[model samples]
Target: MDPTPPVPHDLSPPRDVPLRLRPPRHRVDPRARRWWLLRALASAGAVTVVIGVVWWLWEPARPWLTAPLVLAALWTAARAVVEPRVRYAVHRWEATDLAVYGLTGWLVREWRVAPLSRVQTVDAVRGPLEQALGLATLRVTTASSSGAISIRGLDADLAAELAERLTAVTEQTPGDAT
Candidate 1:
């Protein structure tokens, strides 16, 4: 026998059990597309502008030096334009009797949960950009260092309703934390 005792978890398979760890699936409103597009454009435009200015000031490098930066900025912008849609497709949320779960992130997937009893607060915020786009962000705070769960690009009304529902549930349900 090996010197060290085999840990229980070490004996388990590497593959994740989707039903247990996987969050419930739900897509965001289509308006998220427009918001993402505007965000991408603004970000890309700023980068491009900065590159153009730098190229102008650093005359020796001329067009060659800034060419790569311009191309990269455009590519990043393009990706940004499509990011929201991809994120929306993968976004999932479920409020069970035990807890509220929110799954977000595009390239780096993150699954977060906040037990109803442990929920310290729930809020819906809409900034100027979100207002213009008819969107709002839902934030749920728990007593964890992992921090709050922020779901952005939700329809304004839906966010508001979810916030209210979360508040009600948090009040009625008991937290399962030790």
Candidate 2:
């Protein structure tokens, strides 16, 4: 067997860090969670209203039908209000590292990380609803067929900036297509 030892990870500032040991890319702006909550609330409200209207028209078992609708509305509203308040932590990308990570949850936190080098493309998609909300979705495509990982409900400017930055990094990497 060869007698070689692995190098320790150098923990230093951006200026002093080596090219390979730089911090990883990560960022989180959960400020737009309110929009998600609003959307969810709107959906629940629409469903409840539809059921109410149907009950008025059809005159079905009032208590049986309305009870579940009421419970669902309350539960959905509670989740909407509560989920957004959960903290989402994001980390910025580092020079040597390609991945950016984000973690979010109240009781059960979840983490998502993407490698900048693996990114095939970055796009800014603005839909009618997002346009009204002044938000955009940043999608990063990877080599896998599962489709891109998209983060939505981000401030337009911030999303654009992040997308541009990621694109630049991806293009600059060696062997990356022009």
List the global CA lDDT of all models: 0.71, 0.58
TM-score of each: 0.76, 0.68
Query: What count of clashes does model 2 give?
Result: 10
| Clashing residue pairs in candidate 2 (N, C-alpha, C atoms within 3 angstroms) | 24-93, 24-94, 25-92, 25-93, 25-94, 26-91, 26-92, 26-93, 27-91, 98-116
The residue-by-residue lDDT of candidate 2 on 1-178, one tens digit each, is 2232332222223555433433334333444565667766778767877777776777656767788678777867766876555532332222123544444344674445555566789888887667777878777787646556676656677677767877777787554422
Kindly provide the TM-score of model 2 when superposed on the true structure, using C-alpha atoms.
Answer: 0.68
Model 2 misplaced stretches (Cα beyond 4 Å)? 1-31, 87-97, 104-109, 175-178
Cα RMSD of all models vs. native, in order, equals 11.9, 10.2
Collision count for each candidate, in order: 1, 10
Task: Give the range where candidate 1 is weakest over 10 consecutive residues by summed lDDT.
Answer: 4-13
How well does candidate 2 score on lDDT at residue 177?
29
